[model samples]
Target: MALSLWRSVFGGSTNAPEDGGVAFWSSPERAGWLTKQGEYIKTWRRRWFVLKHGKLFWFKNSVVTRASIPRGVIPVASCLTVKGAEDTLNRAFAFEISTRAETMYFIADSEKEKEEWINSIGRSIVQQSRCLADAEVVDYGSSEKR
Candidate 1:
């Protein structure tokens, strides 16, 4: 009964890992607070960012409520890199995510937090690449093991 309620409310499978088994990130990788640029506009706003299922999600604030949906989401698999953007706008704790679609900029509270986000996102990209490589491998005819 409770499980069904959770699935119906969250719209995702209960058996799926809560954080999508992102082993590189922290146990609760939603600790980073960042300022994200609006998707379509030039305005920037503060948001609480979470990484899960090879994607990055942003909320209005740090406290995640069941009723509140994520304000924005970026697919980490499509992201090419996460690196420091100290040159951009002269912000020391700034980092950027370069995706196939667009580059997104964010400001972390400190240098340490900025590095953590970069490391986590970097790991996600590598993991996705490995998964894709494994899936692409095919034994044409000589499957000795099989």
Candidate 2:
């Protein structure tokens, strides 16, 4: 219940910043936050009343697919957003692609898999930039009010 509340306020887990670490929020939408757990977005699962932003949205994705990554160096590729890059305590914050129209997947596993994907024309995966391309930043100046 409380977990659901936090989710409502923060939009979704995918929108949270990874660098912040893991944090549980009562009002996750606020900026310049510093709480008991102000790092990665928490599920808010540890409280009562089910805060406005605490629910399924906080969990991001719940999909689990058969992946060869679990057997090799990267033992959880299908479950990762950027399997080959960083390893989060939970997988889903990275930049992963799973389109079905003309789909091809990349899992971080044995050296051969990584090498093959990199050397191949498609199915290539790499570390992604952390900045939003065209997003507007809310300046801290108090000169104007919206």
Candidate 3:
């Protein structure tokens, strides 16, 4: 039973990355129901949002039973930022994620849910930025920052 639960959350064995890198982190930081703005129209649709690997993925239904093929994905890379959109949208439960290319707005079921998503995504963005900064090489030979 425990093993099955573990496999359902992560995977049994075939959950490795395509390039043979490390496997995806087993658990999601946050997963819940949220409404997403459509691309072409102003229509909003409900989806199961999963935050993993600094990316937000939407599923049609449950994350466990489904094959985890995301209907849509919002990559929260280091450059991305998450903020409340109550002022812009005039909705208490609204938040937006902006990247270099585009900005996506989402509405949570409640104010609490919205706050949780914002904090989780904000932490993810900070974590990604730290990873990027750590991977960068500091030039001691040059006169930059010392």
Candidate 4:
């Protein structure tokens, strides 16, 4: 079957945990399967991705136990942008997430999935950035109490 073939080729038995199996405490904001471009080889490899606690993590398999180790991780706070990159990659459902140092590309299953990922990641970036900013603000009332 096509599904089995996809699994064999991609190394993912199922979609990544949609209900947050990766983290111990809270559910992940989003999780799914995406084909990501290799860092140096220019090859594409299917990865199970999870977005949680302002971080994006990818694994080789969908089964994420407490001992599971992510193949890679991108802190959402460090990301500057998440946007469609179909034109740049010449591939459908392609998008890019970039920080100051690098841009990583991923291909979703469909246009809808692509947009969903972009929105989720974009929101995470904004939310995480805001949290950092909030932490830096001086609290005059707290200072007065001391």
Candidate 5:
């Protein structure tokens, strides 16, 4: 199974970088990715909002299963969870994490637009068996803390 470095950055795995902004990490089956907690096992799920045609097409970051979300138009960013591959594919929770920059997609433009789009879809994307607990939060330094 192939995982991305984003999972590691989110504390999903600590295995260092490999190439193309992508890294290899070992995630679990059921849902979240697996990380070693001092020899013990810790499961963490990543989540993100996907935007297609200026709307919330889906929300997943772990092991989500669904058909390939077609990039109907230029995406304007997203706030969905990110994760490694294999476990997330097909599962509504898993998303093949990537370091390709393009994969760092979040929000449809503004959080407001995203919320509106999501709400328009019935606000069911955030339902259980869909939305997973976020990975440990971190400061990536983007919103002006530079």
Candidate 6:
């Protein structure tokens, strides 16, 4: 039921691969190539990013399957802000996703791409937060009834 809704919205399968390769049915809300800053080295590396189910996942390449593990994953619900940081980074298409712990930087291919990524992440954060709130409400109501 939930998987069906996820597929309906993202247009991908949730099934694991039969051969233990990539899960071809895994559909993302948004996917593209972007350059991301390395956490320790402070260097930028090109990566393939997929946004789905209120999570942002990056891989070495776009050929994601069930066997392919993400290089990094960011839970959108934990994010505090998503905004362009071109001037601060001195990069043309740079943006930032900031959480309480740290701020991650990324550079898109163009201005439109940068804005689109920011918007997508912002929407995911809002959606995830709302889901959390809805769950809390349900729990509160159930406890009251009990």
Indicate whether candidate 3 or candidate 6 has the larger TM-score.
6
Please write out the lDDT profile of model 1 over residues 1-146, one tens digit for every residue: 32333343345555432433333134454456899766667687898887865667666777664444555556566778899998985877889998665778898888888988999989888988888899899887876764
Q: lDDT tens string, model 2, 1-115?
A: 2222233333443234221232323342111110111123543221111111111112222221221011001111121232332243222222122322211222333445443
Residue-level lDDT tens digits of model 5 in 1-146: 11322342224432322211211122211111221111122333233333322222222343233332211211122233343332433222222222234332222333444344334333322442143434445566756753
Best-performing candidate as measured by lDDT: 4
Which regions of candidate 5 deviate over 4 angstroms? 1-104, 117-122, 128-146
- Which should have the higher TM-score, number 3 or number 4? 4
TM-scores, each model vs. reference: 0.73, 0.18, 0.74, 0.78, 0.17, 0.78
What's model 1's lDDT at 51? 81
Q: Write down the lDDT that model 6 would get.
A: 0.77
The TM-score of predicted model 1 comes to 0.73
Summarize candidate 3's per-residue lDDT along 46-106 as a digit string, tens digits. Answer: 9887777766666678644333445555556623679899898887799998866566788
Tell me the lDDT of model 6 at 37: 92
lDDT of 2 at 8: 33
lDDT on C-alpha atoms for all candidate structures = 0.69, 0.24, 0.68, 0.78, 0.29, 0.77
After TM-score superposition, what is the CA distance of residue 141 in candidate 5 from its true location, in Å? 51
CA lDDT, candidate 6, residue 145: 50
TM-score of 4: 0.78
Residue-level lDDT for 20 in candidate 3: 20
- Residue 25, model 5: Cα distance from true site in angstroms: 36
TM match of model 5 to true structure: 0.17
Per-model RMSD to reference? 7.7, 17.5, 8.6, 9.5, 17.2, 8.1
Candidate 4 error regions (>4 Å): 1-26, 139-146
